[model samples]
Target: MAVHLFTEWSKSPGHLDHWERTGREQGEECGLPNLGQTCYLSAVLQCLYHTLPLTHYLISQAFKEDVVKRSPSRGQVVQAAADILTEMDRGKPKKGTLAYFKGVCGRMDDLFAGSGQREAHDLLSSFLTWVHQDLSSSRNACKKCGLEPERRSTISDIFEGIHRATIICPESGAIICSIHERFWSLSLPLNNPGETPLEDALQQYYHTRAIKWYCHYCRREHLCHRQMHILFLPKVLILHLNRYNIKGSDPKLNWVTFPTEELTLDGHLTPGQKGRPWSKFSLYSICNHHGNKKRGHYTACCRSNHPQHVQTPWLFFDDEEVRPIERFKNPRDAHILFYIGVSQVQQESRQTCLASGGMGLQ
Candidate 1:
């Protein structure tokens, strides 16, 4: 009987095998159609899809429930967007998803309608804001006290940072410290015209500056040194290079060199927080802008997660075309960089801290 069953199973059609092969091929080369001037949207979506944890969260059942329970109207847009991306991830591509996303955007704002190119950074900001508003839950238990408390939303904090202000009085040698805890992204200014390293740019951001200060303690004015510090570092770090200056519309076409592997932030972490030691991240995605101020194109390069590959593969997405690239041809055009936590211990610690209701700039 066993032999007979085995013979019949072996003789059955290879439909399952064929389907698996087809799915693998499709998933390896999935691309989004250029819906008019929606390349900005496409670039952002591709980058988001590459963020494995975010993709997993979006496609999870929890996200579906949160959307329905929250704002159903605006939530539907996020749901639709997530659903479309989920389908693509499952190797079931839908061209109509782009259309649906566009329709939702149009209904939400008039600025996103029609075939006009928009800034990719602005689109990412709006998308993140919408997603954060809809899916964020307040019921997460605190890891320390084991009680639910009024805390910062996990979704928002994943991308948020702290801006610290320090004032010093020269005459009395008095010092004051203040912290402003909210920044979605870090704006890094370039020094040279052609090239700047990521570390250098970050150093420039936290560099000390001399400012005129009125010391209330001393009741006098004095020249004081001021400095900014990163009070909180998010699990996913998004760095935006300030290429477009206020002087003119022209963008700085300088090559901003960034680490392709590990990005250590121990030096940038807040003083007390530095003892925790979870300041390393792995580069995952990059959004590059081509052309100048008048007219430009957006493209994204993302790390591909395939079990067979020895080294992580980086694939370039230009509109509807997807191709594997050894390295970014033009690193200067890199406008947005995404990095995710790589240390498991650090990740667990962060989760524990968030779960314990210790969610803040510590």
Candidate 2:
């Protein structure tokens, strides 16, 4: 199964067959026997990559449940597995330790301590350190203050970091600048710059070759660039409404209604707004062109409009260029540096997307 998932069977037919026949010979040699385990771990890490809601302890217990249900580990193996997962959940496990253990168990060594246990322990230790280093980025605080109190001190950050790390290969120096190229083309709202970190969040991708690219909206990383898609407002609006209660009374309250005019085919690109005095929903505008001369026009209230006109044309639509679903040709093309820096709110879930108006990129 691991071979099937990871290997390009059609591209390397006989090679896959050979590996499958030998039962993951390469993985075994690399100390990972179970491709399924690595796949599972990768999926979990990616899920947590989006947002980690469960506590480390709870995550460990969940892993125990999964492994125990599959194997007749009596309580000993279950307990040991739980311990290993616990260390991983708490960011103490080494790089790929969970997947490695899943691969090496029963094939390479025993877990009853001694050399086998020591190796396992070392793996877990290394994983944990990596998790800490990657996820635990330090925020600068003033000499008199603990400014980064809102930072999430958990393993999720590391997962995101790791996901981001894939695109960067120091050895090859291969890069894709897709995000950077579309930087001006895409419209996004800005937030307080002081609260967001600016370093290499999106900058590193400026020119590095990326083996895989994650869709920000879907939370699935390691995706082919061609598979990427800009989010449409309708779905994004729903997600925001459900998550943040967009319509209900709040300080950020703004009305976002559907279009009275027919939808267009060509999408619009309204410049994103920054600072206050502007509703968050008004930040970016995306209108699909419906092939009509007046296709791009939609209801909207500008500063000059009175309350009645505001309500009348409050619904805005757009018609601009639609970005193709392509792998960022270079890292800079994917560098949402300004957007990320302006929008990163430490207190909010990292995965949470802000609500935009009708015909907007949700």
Candidate 3:
């Protein structure tokens, strides 16, 4: 049954049977073994493994000191992740499993601890938060100021971005105040997905609006213009299409066409960011949900930038099965989109396409 899906996706019967994908054959990573209902975890692990920045940091073993300094129990999540990523990178035992990482995650987070299934985005979010917390330096409040220090780590540096909203008073257009907030992902409003394009959604995100403000600068209750802009861009940008509502609303299944090659943020950026180099991102990975919240299963389709994976440029990861995907063609199931920063020189070649026929090689 599952084999049929892979066949249709690859459009090649012999592709999945290739011996190289089965084991650790230098530079080739093995499929993650999903025990019955562990497809969500398997998909998440595969997506994270292909995240070059995070995977590189893990394989580089920069977290060794952080692991050693903390209590053995507190450091297990990142350590476990590092172990699993390394195993995937170097390959081992024909396939892969995340027993240790799952165990550690189950221990720290109740979502994975239960016998029942968990959502992929929830699981991914938790894993990143746990790793970031473990690697961050601030565990306790400052001794002198009694303030909890800001948590900082390479994880934050890679995945986080800052947004600033400047409130301007109507009176003489005086600057009221600037509010800055850090975010790991961009949550889009799906209230009206009927005719919204990706660029329109992005524009709405940084849109300027009017608000009733009692600004100290104005010293009165007057209309103030509130404008928001991206203060800082992350190396990896995540767009979380808010499909499932916590209040039990129906999930938005409408498809919005998004640019995979040049998702430029110049218009949404502040004047300050213009001074910096090209502020754009190219699509890297996508976590697609197949069904509704109750019965949905997640799968990841990642764009491989690594030279070794050029042959299989677009790889589909469904549970333990990995194969070349025929085409993306504006995915309606796109839930989480991962975008990576690219320079002007790097953006010259826009191979934003899924593989088709045979191996889908260059």
Candidate 4:
């Protein structure tokens, strides 16, 4: 399959230059036409587009090379995504990339076809899997030895973590432990019945759990414990709240209070690792769902990098319409939240301002 470049559109007499100039003048608020019931996908895309590292990577030459190397025939989703990012960066009107993305998604799953409304989390998982397939690699070696190139492969380490399971024998008091790396998004359960704080939910997620198991070390049945810990911090952190309860068909609308400025993850890290003392992150975007499971609307709010704004800026994207907001007063409907490291925010802000030609403040 031949690769299609955004430059192909440059043939239309200064279209690309005009788009760039307009974007520099006005803040980027490129909208997307709703492809039937693709609001979920659109919301996910909006949040991901606001992710600085992800947006930068998608438009980078390395991403294109990786797409060609990993997915030769089925690279339309990625290609379309990149084109959308480019168009948005240039401050162009909505060109509608939903058709391309929907086509690829339908090929993967039947539920994604037509005007059927799918879960945002499910679509996000599929999209991330497709995009980050060949973006990372793993190394296998002993504690003393260095990396083993033979075991290396494409690996995205942003959401990676380790799951540790420990088994203790009741009779002999012997203990057995095992640790393994996990590459996936973290789903935090709303265990508490009433309103819960985001930090409290995270604590519950990493809290140790005891269960009955057979201990191989002492060859006897005993109690076992399992815990999860962060292996390393990623440039962008995505957290999905599991709101739907199995017992009750209704979705949990309980308020999940999350930090707007900073979230430290020092307690979740594994011991003896040389990772940062505290993984601090600042809110960048939020994917919120309104109404119930059967009928609902998906919308997203992203931190705006427009240099002209006096106060902190945020834009809410509802399908083809975009509007600015001060901040999220109520976070009850916040389903998926995106955060980036504080250290990188300043650099990204500078890039955003430079890209926009340093527009005058209002």
lDDT digits (tens) for residues 1-362 of candidate 4: 22111211112221212111112233356667787777898898888777654565565544665554445235666677777776666566354456776777777677787788889998988877666543433456524222223232222434433444445555665656655555456788775566888899899988887777777875766667665676556545788988775456455546588876557777786666544322466677899998777779899988775322223467889988888775456457898988755443444554476467653222
lDDT string, candidate 1, 297-333, tens digits: 9999887753211244578899889888764443668
Q: What's the lDDT of the predicted structure labeled candidate 3?
A: 0.68
Ranking by lDDT: 3, 1, 4, 2
Which regions of candidate 2 fall more than 4 Å away from where they truly are? 1-65, 71-78, 84-362
lDDT of 3 by residue, 234-282 (tens): 7778887766755565565455678766788888887656512445777
In model 1, which regions exceed 4 Å deviation?
Answer: 1-26, 68-73, 139-154, 211-213, 220-223, 249-253, 275-277, 307-310, 327-330, 344-362
Q: Largest TM-score belongs to which candidate?
A: 3
Which residue ranges in model 3 land beyond 4 Å of their true spot? 1-29, 71-73, 93-97, 138-149, 210-212, 221-223, 246-252, 275-278, 308-312, 349-362
TM-score of each: 0.78, 0.19, 0.79, 0.78
lDDT of each: 0.65, 0.24, 0.68, 0.63
Decide which is better by lDDT, 1 or 4.
Answer: 1
The ten-residue window of minimal lDDT in model 1 covers: 1-10
Itemize residue pairs with steric clashes in candidate 3. none
Deviation (Å) of 348 in candidate 3: 2.4
Score candidate 4 by lDDT: 0.63
Compare the candidates by lDDT and give the number of the best one: 3
Each candidate's number of clashing pairs is: 7, 55, 0, 3
